[model samples]
Target: MVHEYQKDDESSVNSADEALFEMLGILPSLAIGNGVPDEEDDENSMNDKGGAQALSLDRFVQRKDDNWIRKVLANSDNINLRRQYETTSVCVFPEALRIPAIEMRRLADELVWGGHIYPSDKTYETLRISKDGSIEERRALTRIENFVNYHSGWNALCNDYLRRLVSLALGQPMVLYKEKLNLKPPGGSGFAPHLDTPSLRVALGDRGPREFCTVMVAIDNMTTRNGCLRIAKGVWSEDHHVNTVQPKAEGNPDADGRAGAVLPELVDQLQFEDLVCVGGTIVAFNGWAPHRSKTNLSSFARRAVFLTYTLAAEGDFHDAYYQEMEHLRNKWRDKVGLPTQISNDELMELNALSTVPRT
Candidate 1:
C-alpha cells in the first residue's frame, strides 16, 4: 500500500517515518547477484549475443518491489510541491550509481538478440530498424528485436531510483506494468511526437484512464551532438494532449494510421531541449509530455533504457512483447500471482545489513 501523504500532525509523520524505517530494516537482503561484494571486475564482460551473463527476473522483480515501497513513502513530504512548480518533469543529475558497462553489455546482448540494433558505440551512434522495408527481414536485427524483452535488464533497467523519483513527482502510487519495450539507441528518430492514448479525453472512455509516467535513464553521456531527448515544456498543461510531427492542416489524410495523427503546429512550437546528463542521471515526466529524441551524433554509444508505470490497480500490467514468446510469457504470468498487485509491505519485516551502507 502507498504511504498516505496527507496526515494530520507531526507526531503521525514521525510515527510513519519510524514504521517505514523498521520495514526497511526487516526487508530481506534481496538476492541481487550482480551486487555481491566479492564479485570480480566485470566492466566489459558482455560480448556474445546470448550467453550465461543474462540477468535474472527474480532480482528485477524484487528490486522493483523495493523501489515501489520507497517511492510511496518518500513523496509524503512533497505532496504540495507541485502547486508551486511550473512543469511536472523533474530531472536528477549525477544519479546514485552506474549500472556498470558489463551489466549494460550483458543486457545489450539480450536487447540485440531481441531484434534491437547493436551499433558501434562511437560518435554518430544510432539505432536503425526498418519499420516497413526489406531491411526488417535481416536475420541479425530481427533476432535482437525478438529477444530483447525477455532479458532481465530490459525491465529492471528502469531501476528503483528512477521509479521512486516519478512517484515522488506524481504524488501517486506508481506500478510498472509494461513487459515489452522498444529499444532505441542514440540518434534514433521516432515518428513525430504525440501524447499517450490515456492522456486524451476521448481515449479515456471506459477503458480505465491512463495515468502512466515514464522514467528515462541515460546510460551514456547524452549530448545534443549525439542526439539527446528533447521536450516541449508546459504543453501538457494547455490541453494535456499533443499531435505527432506530420503536418495536419485540416486536409492531410491522417491516412497513414501507423504514424499517429500529425501535429505539425504543436511539434513546431515545442520547446526543444536535450536531456543532457551523465550515465546514471534520471529523467521523469508524464506520459502526455511532448518530447522527442535528437539524432545521435556522439562517438560513444548513447545507450539508455525507459520504464513506464501506471497506478498498480488502475491499468493493464501484461507484457506486450509476450506475444513474441508465448512460453516465457506464461512463465511470467505464473510468477506474478496477484491480479491487481502492488508491492508487498511484508518486506519491511526483515532487517537491512548494518555493516553495509546503501551505496
Candidate 2:
C-alpha cells in the first residue's frame, strides 16, 4: 500500500525527509551487504524472469479472501488512474510503496555499491560482458538502456508485491521483462525525448508491439528541479515522428522512425508535464509515450526504478532479454576498445536520449 501524502501522516513526511537527506548524501543508514549481497539477500530469490515461485491461482481467485489486498489493488488500479493513462498515456500513484525507511535505505545501499556504480562520465566508462558472461566495467555510469545487470536488483523488481501491483494496475497478469534504475545525481542532465516501445516490443512475447507498459518506482522524491521525467501528454497513440529538430511546429514528430530524439520543435510544442511526486510513487505509462528528464540543478540525487512488463500469457523474456543485452554491450565494448570511451554525442546517436548529464 502507498502511504498517502496527506497532512498529519508522520510516516510519509518522515520518509520524504529521509529520502531528501539521503539524496544529499548527508544521512547515513546501515550499509546493506558487502556490495552485491548474495542469494541470501532474499528468501524469494527465485523470482528469475517470470519464474517466480509457483503459487496456485486459487489464492488469487475466489476473490473472497484478502479483502484488503483486493481493495488496495482496486484503489491502485482504480478507474480514474486507468482512464487517465488511457487518455493521456501517463498517470501516477503517489507515495505508493509503503516499505519502511530502514528497508528502503538498505535496498538503495545494496544497489548503489552492489555491482557497478558508473560515474556520469561515459567518455571513459563502458560495461562489457565477455562471451562467457564475465562482466567488465570500463568508464562511465548507468541509464535506462544501460544499467545494473545485478541479480539482486532483478529480484527486487520481480518481488510478488510489485508483480501484484503492476498486474492489478494493468488489469492483467504480467511477466516482468526488463528492469533498470536511473540514478540521476545532482547536476546530472536529463535524457532527450524518445519512445520506449520500439525496444520494449521484443519483450511482448506473443503480444503486439503496443502491448507493453513500464512501471516506474520512485526511489527518491522526483522534482522538476532534480531532473524528474517530463512527459508529453495525450500523445501515446500517435505516430508522431518527423525529420525535424526543435523550434519549428507544435505536435510535429520529434524524430524519424529509427532511434532518434524527438525534434526540438516538437518538444517545445508538446505539452509535457513534470511528474513531481514523493518517494515510492509508481508512475505507469504506455511504451509509446514520449518522455524525457531535465538536468538536476538541486543538490540531491533522483533515483528511480523502471520495471517493464507484458501480459503473462505472452511469456517471460526478462532474463533472455538481459542476456542478449549483455552480449551486445560486451560486443560493443570489445569493438570500441578500452581507455577511449564513447562520447555523449555518440551515445545520443545510439540511444536517442536527447538530454545527458554535462560532463
Candidate 3:
C-alpha cells in the first residue's frame, strides 16, 4: 500500500501524483484504490509484514468527512483553523516543487561546499539510534545547520508553495521558524520514534503558543531500503498518554532525553506509515506525531531539507533557534568539560580550506 498526503479534491489532483505513485517502495498496482485501509489492516500491521509486504498505509487519516480536514480540503482560502494537522499528524504533497536533475545536483554540490557539515554525535538525541539497534551514531556521515541562511534558492522554493500548504493544513497563518539540512550517508544513523513538540518547546522556551508544523522537502529519493521516514498513525500531543512507550529511556542526559522514544517492544501497538517519497516531494507533519526512520545502508546517499514553521502569531524564531542551539551546545560542552564556541568564520575556513572531510 502506498500512502500519499495530498489535497482531497480528486479533480485538483495533479499529474505529478502519478509519478509519485510510480516511485513508491511498495507494490504500485495493489489494485487497492480505496481511500483508507480496511479496519482489520488499520488495527495492526504485523500480519502484513509477515506476509512479505511491510506495514504500509494507503490512507490512515484520509477520511473525506473528517472535520479537521473537510474545511481545509474545501479549497477555500478564507478559513484559518490549523487543527487538521493536529488531528492527522501528517500530510504529503507530491512533487510540490519541480527541480530539474541538473538543478538538484547543483543544490547538493553547493550545500556540500558552503554548508557546514558535522559528523554524527552519539550523545545527541536525534542521532542516538544506530542501525544495529545500538545507541551509537555512525561515522563518515555529516550534517549542516543554518542552511537557509546561505541559500536563496531554497528560500524561493519554500516560499513558492510551502507557506500556503502549511497554512491550509494548520488552519492559520504560518512563518518559517527553523530550517535544517539532514544528510544521511551510507552508515548514517536514523532517529527513534518520538514526537517533535518536546524538543521544539525547549528550543522556543515556552513561547505563548505550543504547536508548530514541519515541511520535509526531499532532495533525494527516499526509500525503505534507504531509511525513509516511518510514522505511527492517529497519535498527537493532546491525546498522548503519559505512561506509554518511552521514545528515549530515562536517565539519558537532558530533560528531553526520554521524552519521545517508542520502545521496540511497544512499536507493534501502533500502525506504521512507511514514506517512500520521490525527490521534490514535500511531507508536512505536525510536531507531536511519532515518527522515526531507519539507517541508510543503501549505495545512494539520502539528503533532505527540513523547513519548520511556527504559527505566524508566535513570531519568527529562526535566529533565536540557531542562537539557542549554539547556547545549548556550549552549555553541554562546558558541562562535559570540552572546548566550546566555534565561530562561523572558523567553520567557513574549515570547509573552504578542506581541513576535515567536506562531505
Candidate 4:
C-alpha cells in the first residue's frame, strides 16, 4: 500500500517494461551468485554463450532499473492506482534528474523561513463543513509571497525553450511563475489532490483548449521514500464541472476527505505513481491534473518549490471561487513576469533537456 516514486540509492524502471522477472519468483541469470568472476577484478572473464559477466558491488550499485514493484494481485482493479485517479492527471517526465541534497539545502532554509510550513493534513485551513474550519490559521508569511513575487529568479530561467516545450506538451501556451515551498513533518502529506485554480478563466471561459500550465521545479531532490508529488498522467485539458462537496463531518474533519468523491466501482481502475525529480530538473505536468503526495517515510525533511504559469491570453483561474486569487494577482501584478516568446533554436535546446534514456 506504500507507493514510492523513484527513491535515491535505489533503482528505477522504465514504463514500457511489461514485467519484472523476479515477480514470478524466478531468479534472473544476472543474480549476484552467477558463475562469472566477481566484477571487482578487472578484465573479468565472460561466458561466450550468454555474454554474461560477473557483477561487482560497483555495478550492482549503478544499475538503473526502476524498483517500483508492480501490483500483481490486481490489474484494472488496483486500489492504489484508482486512489491516484481521483486527485489529478498524471505524466511521467522521463529521465528526471534528482537534485542533490547539498544543492537543496539553501532552498530548504527559505521554505522554513517563508512560513509556508503546514502539517500536510489540511487542518490549517477550514472548510465550510467544519464549524471550526473557518477558525483555522493561515500559517503563511507575507514575506514568502513577496519572495515569490520578487526575489525568486525562476521567471528569468523559464526561458523560451521551457515555455515552448510546455506549450507543445500540454497543447497550450505556458508560462513559469514563482516556485512554491512545502515543509511538512514525517507522515505528513503535502497538498491534497486538486486541480490548479485557473488565474484567467472568467475573462476567457474554460472552453476549447487549455491556455496555461504550472511547472514544478524541485528545489530539493524528490524521492519516493520522502513523499514526492504524485500525479495522475494524461488527464490535462479535460473539462470537468467543479462541484462543491459539503462536509458531512461535524467538525468538517479535513480537506482530504472532502476534496475527492470516491468512485467505489472504478477504484479498481485508478493508477498512481510517484514523480521523483533531481534538483534543477523541472516537472511540467498539466496544472489541472489531479495530484497528491504520499506520506513521507524518510528521515530527512521534504522541501520543494512550484513554478505556476498561464497562457498569454488566458484569464486567471485561481479566483474562480473566491476574491483572494484576484486580489493576489492585482496586488502582485507588477511582480509577475510575462511569458517569453520562443524561437526555433530555443526549441531545439529545450528538446535536449529531455532526460529520457535511449535504448
Answer with 1 or 4, whichever has the higher lDDT: 1
lDDT of 4 by residue, 239-351 (tens): 75232233333221212124233223433344556876654354665555555666554433445555556665654333231243223323333233422222333222221
Model 1 accuracy (lDDT, Cα): 0.39
TM-score of 1: 0.50
lDDT, candidate 1, at 86:
36
TM-score of each candidate?
0.50, 0.61, 0.61, 0.45
Q: For candidate 1, lDDT tens digit of each residue in 1-359?
A: 01112223222212333354347773111111111111122222221123554334344345545455455435545533344223544344222223443444346544444333432111111133332232221111101222323444454454344455455555566766432222233223332455533322222235544565666655444555545667665636435555543322222111212123335565566675666654434556666676665443222234565566677557554343223223332333345442222233332111111001110
TM-score of 4: 0.45
> Candidate 3, residue 2: CA error in Å?
30
Q: How far is candidate 4 from the true structure (C-alpha RMSD, Å)?
A: 17.8
Residue-wise lDDT of candidate 2 within 51-107, one digit each (tens)? Answer: 454222232222323355457656654446667878888877533233222233345
Instruction: Give candidates' CA RMSD values in order.
Output: 19.3, 11.9, 14.0, 17.8
Q: Score each candidate by Cα lDDT.
A: 0.39, 0.50, 0.51, 0.37
Better of 1 and 3 by lDDT: 3
Distance from true location, Cα of 345 in model 3, Å: 17
